[model samples]
Target: MIAYYVHHQGSGHVHRASSIAAQARTPVVGLSGRPRPAGWTGDWVDLPDDSDGVDASSRDVTAGGTLHWVPRRHAGLAERMRRVSETVARASLVVVDVSVEVALLARLHGVPVVVVAQPGERTDRPHRTAYDLAERILAPWPVRPAGGWPDGWTAKTVHLGALSRFDAHPAPAAGDPCRVLVLWGRGGIDVGPDRIAAAAAATPGHRWVVAGPHPGPGAWPANLTWLGWVDDVWAELSAAGVVVTHAGQNALAEVAAARRPAVVVPQRRPFGEQDATAAALARAGIAEPTGSWPEPAAWPALLARAAQRGGTGWDAWSTGTGAARAAALLDGLAA
Candidate 1:
């Protein structure tokens, strides 16, 4: 059996976990604060939220801010660690996607750990410590050129380009009036309603659709329609002539799968993760990236440029078999 630790922050971690776990030959067990997703057949162990009983005055959340997060005197934290300890004792390999504390715990318990690598400035002590201790580092994107990763850390790393649930979905035909899908994740975009409305008004010919949590307040223009959060992300991407989204790993990979051009507006993330991801996409000619949100007046040119690209260079990022590739790696480790 293999143990998989899914971070309960955004849906991305769990989504990625589910994709890879489905391809695993061995029975996979999941540990997370989030509930087991619909299609997962694996045994699940629900972990309590560590942030639930945090007390700054009484308990130490971090070991002097050196470790990522370890709430001192936290019952939930203690229980979660205990569960992990118990699981690792029975499992042959542990996959973390990801938490530094969990990675350390698994390693200390004498279990080999595969740590998921996120795109960002991960030169910090906590990140470095986890990377150093990991038996393998799984990068979701294609192997980036030199200078992006930490020194000597890429040797044990396996670059599995953009794992997405919809990689096998056929590219959707372009819709009339040029449908534009705007995706927002849990982190939410920095773009405001006024700007979105202004952009909609400026491009009256195209239909603008906003999806995901927190679409912002106020009424939208007639051309702009808010879908809020929808279960079918691929449907929206398929119908879109172009997509405007944050530079999140899952979102980017999904866009690549749909074979649609995108205007990437990176939201603020730890260590400028989104910024780094957007830069890579732009360099690869996969997407048009604006360091920040583009002005409403600049939308016309930006969208036009994105549409012209037509998501031609995205196959390198969306291999369509990344899940199988990652699963094969786990199978090898388990063996």
Candidate 2:
């Protein structure tokens, strides 16, 4: 049996975990702070309701424009842990995804942990301690400068490369006309309705798809297709000529694997991590940063540049086996 600790921060964590779990031949359960997305194949423990006003760390679902945060019920954590303990009691190993408390509890129950994280995202001391407790730390990026990781963790750190949906399918057909994919995850804050409308109106010739939690029904423009949350986005990506999206790790990884070019619009926070991701893609010459939207001229030029560099030495990252490799390392720790 395997237990997957899901934070429900963004779809990226769950999205990556699903691909990995598909390769696993074990019973897996998921626990999240928010309601599970559609088609999750694990036993779920729903989080407490948040009827109160939004706080600092709240997640804004674009559809209703409401900010969501992990509910803090005194009984909730305890109850969830009781369930986790029962599951872990029969598990060969536990895989923790960026949750400090979950990692600690798994250790308390004598279950070895496997951590899934991007390279520079693991700077926290608690996470470092979790890395120490884990049999292996799986990083989904190329072996560049070791940023944000603790020293002497090299023995446990494995560069499993980028975990992506593209790895599950063949690369996009060569020589397709340029189409763009625009993904906005931290919606309402990052990419607003007006901006999406402007972009859609500006570029009529290129095909575009906007995915993420929908901001609202009437918010979308007719030129762009809206998918609330996509279970499989690769078919659209494979058919696309370019990707115009938020600087999500998953989005970048997918486009990179498809060997397509991208025009990235960095998310202005309240939602962090977009800037780093966008800048990295820009530096690699796969995508460029478009600070503001509604610029039809700029987008075409950026997309053109991306297309010229398509399928050019992009797979030099890590092999496409991060999850299974990480899982095997975790199993050895339990042994």
Candidate 3:
């Protein structure tokens, strides 16, 4: 059995976990705090049911083979550690995305773990330390030639490329001009409607779609279409010619996987992780950086440049042959 432990802090980890669970032939179980994506076969814990409101603050729920919760802040360290230990005990193998506690628990259980991340320069230190405890560390993008993990760690660290959720989904219908899809996370602080409206107005020839968990009312322009969280963001992703989005690790990879070039605007919040994500993509020559948000007039030319640059087919490194090989390695450990 494969146990997927997701922190639910970002949609990227859940997206990554969904891809892994979908590919696993074994009985896959998921533990997450975020709302589970549709069509995922595994039993998931703490996933919200349809009756649940999007704004509900209920921090914890469990169903299927997963456990989901927002950890209490006042809990003692020992008690929190005990709870994590219990969760780890139930799984033979633990697969985590960028969770430090997950690594600690997996180590206690002697359960091999696969740590998935696209590390930026800032978190490199903690990430490396976490990697020390992991059985294998999976990098979701192509590896740079220098200043990476040491050779002793090389045997365990694998650049599995970017994981794309659209690989199996049917494509969405083509829209007028080229549809530009802009997506943000649950927080409105990072990406606001102003950028979306401006982008739509600046690129008069193109249609713009905004997606995320619905942030309450704002003045939406006629050119911008507000598409709240849909079951098939991937469908929209497939149909988009230009994706203007935040520097979400999974989002960037998904854009690359679709073979479309994108203009990425890094988020300034939560410690500038988006900037790190954008930096790597920019360095890779796969993405054009627009800081937090770019001006609408700037997008037309950037979109044109992205169209010319095209996608680098990074999906093969994560979900394709790379995942297959990683699975084999994991199975060997499970054996």
Candidate 4:
């Protein structure tokens, strides 16, 4: 059995794990602080929330920069690792989607660990230690960046391309010529609703639809409709002429799967994670990336440029077989 540890900070980790689990021939039990998602394939273990009622940042969470999130006095942290250690005893391999501490725990137990590589500037001690310990590093992007990682780790990694739940879903034929879609994750976005409204106003010829919750309560612009947390977002996503979204890997992968060109405004994230992704997508010419949203007046040209780029190149990022490939790797390891 493969024990998958999913980080609870963002939905990306869980979404990626679920996609791979769906295709896994081997039993893949999920371990997370969050509850089991609606269609999880195998047993789901609820790991203790380490940050419950605690100021994680204010305390000595990092062990003086040698590691990440090992709070000194947190009972929840202790219990979380204890449960993970129990799982390690029964698992053939552990897939860390990611947490350095959990990787270390599994490695200490002599279980082979495959780490899900995150896109960011991960050149720190804890990250290096985790990478060194992993039997394989699975990168979810098509191309590993040019520099930073040593040769050994670069060779050890398997580039899985972008994995998304939507990869298997066929993108519907293009819908309205004047549709622009926005996707906001439950993980808070740095971009404001007013700014989105401004962009919508700037492009009155295009109708803007937001598929996630409105960040704040407010009346929307004439052309912009806030469809808060729609049950089926693929409809809006697949039909849009252009998708305006953040640079989170899952969001990007979903957009890629739908074959929709995107105007990517990378939100602020730790270690400049989104920045790295935005740069890669921009270089690939599949998405138009900006450090931040441009003025309202600039939205028209940006949207036009993004739509003109089309989404043919998106398959370069999401090959529609990433999940299957990852599952095959896990199955092989289990065997």
Candidate 5:
């Protein structure tokens, strides 16, 4: 059996893992601090959440800039690694999506590592070490610009494109109302309702809807609707004429699958991860990057520009066979 190490910070990691695991040709086990996702078709073992009692001021969490989030003197970190180390004997390979320390740990234990790559300026020493130790690196995006790294890192990577839970969902029905959807990830972002209200007020004609957590106080504007964490997000996404979302990998894949035009507002991430994706979209003419959340006046033009571009062009971003191909790759690795 192969072990899949999914990062617990955001829902995207688990979403990607679930899609690939569903199509895997071999048995797979999931390891994360998160609870077992609802539809994962594999054995799941919960690892300790490393943030518990983690005080960055107290100790060098980065191990003096050589790693990411390896906080010593933390109980959670110790237990988490211990649990992860126990799986070394049973697994032939470990797919990390993604944590550098875990990838290094798996490699040290003699299990081959498939390191999932995120788009960004990951030329840092920690990232270079992880990629160097990896047997393979899986990138979940279409082939595009490499953010200026050594050719060795780029050579080993297999660009598997994007994967999403809504991959099987059909294209959104045509002729939906002229509305704008603001989608956010479960991963904490700073896009506030007050800021959204200002934009919603500017585009009074277009109905504005928001998904994910926005715990700000105040009754919303009449034109704006807040559907806090809906189960049927695809329904909302499908019915919209334009989607305003962050440039997250999962969100982009879902938008690509829904076949709706989108205005991508990239959230600030470590190593400028989302910024790199937004730039790629601009370069490919798939979507335009607003750089940051647009001002109230900028909303009208941005939304209109995205609508005019249309969503059919996203076929290149998500070919609907990414998960199948990734699963086949993992199967070959297991063999």
Candidate 6:
């Protein structure tokens, strides 16, 4: 059996894990702090939240600043580690999506590990340590010579080219009034309510749909529709004339798969992850980037430029077979 460790930070990690697991040839088991998503066929272990039960006045959550987190005297952390150890004991391969401590632990237990690589400035000691210990590194983008990856790291790395849950889903038919879908991710976008309203007002003829966790400040324009959180993202994408989104990997992959033009706004991320992905997209001429949120006045020109691009160079990034390719790699490792 193959074991997968899904990070609990955001939905992206779990979403990517589920997509890849669905394509796995061997039986897959998942462990995460988040509850198992519906339709997950694999065995799941819901780990207790490590941050829970911590006495802030007394507990040191950082484990002496050596690890990202290992709460002091926390039963959840102990139980979580015990479960991971148990899983590693029986599994042939451990796929981490990702955590340095977990990868190290798996390696120390003698189980081969495949670590997921994200676009970022990840040359720090902890990241480097994990990369060094991993048997293989899986990158979900097309092969690129950038990101300043350390020497010898690429030899064991496989580029799977943008995995998405909607790879097999049909694209939505184009809608009238040129619907522009504005997507905000889990962490929220930097653009404020005034800017979003200004953009809606500036683009009079088009329909602007705002989706994801951003509620915006109070009321919105008549032309703009706010969808707090959506389960049917593909429907929105299909109906869109253009997509305006944060440069999150999964979101970008989905947009590319739908063959829609996009304006990618790079939200601040640790290790410059979003910025790196946005830069690569701009360099490839796949999407237009606003280094920060663009001014309301700049919306007309920016959207026009993005529409002109129209998913021209995105084929290189969104092959729609990434999950299959990633599954094959994992199966090979298990064999």
TM-score of 5: 0.97
TM-scores, in order shown? 0.95, 0.78, 0.78, 0.97, 0.97, 0.94
Task: Kindly report which residue pairs in candidate 6 clash with one another.
Answer: 172-238
Model 1 residue 131 CA deviation in Å: 0.7
Pitting candidate 4 against candidate 6, the one with the higher TM-score is 4
Please list all clashing residue pairs in model 3, or write none if there are none.
45-63, 45-66, 46-61, 46-62, 140-161, 160-317, 160-318
* Per-residue lDDT over 125-200 for candidate 4, one digit per residue giving the tens place of the 0 to 100 score: 9999999999999999997474699888898899988988888898778757699999877767877778889988
Task: Write the residue-wise lDDT of candidate 5 on 24-138 in tens digits.
Answer: 9899999998899998878998998788777787779999999988888788888999989997558998999999999999998999999999888898989998999888888
Candidate 4's C-alpha runs over 4 A off are 56-58, 215-217
**Candidate 2: regions farther than 4 A off:** 25-27, 33-73, 119-121, 186-189, 213-232, 268-272, 289-297, 311-313
Scored against the true structure, residue 329 in model 4 reaches a CA lDDT of 93
Error of 6 at 272 (Å): 0.7
Question: How far out, in Å, is residue 257 in model 2?
Answer: 3.7
lDDT for each residue of candidate 2 in 194-261, tens digit (9 for 90 to 100): 66666666667766676666656675556677777776677667777776776666766776677666
Q: Rate the local accuracy (lDDT) of all candidates.
A: 0.86, 0.63, 0.64, 0.88, 0.88, 0.84
Q: Name the candidate, 2 or 6, with the larger lDDT value.
A: 6
6-53, model 6: which lDDT tens digit per residue? Answer: 988767888889999999999999999889987899899887777776
lDDT digits (tens) for residues 221-257 of candidate 1: 8899878889898878888888999999988888888
For candidate 5, the per-residue lDDT at 77 reads 89
What's model 4's lDDT at 152? Answer: 83
Candidate 6, residue 118: how far the Cα is off, in Å: 1.4
Candidate with better lDDT, 2 vs 5: 5
Poorest stretch of ten by lDDT in candidate 6:
169-178
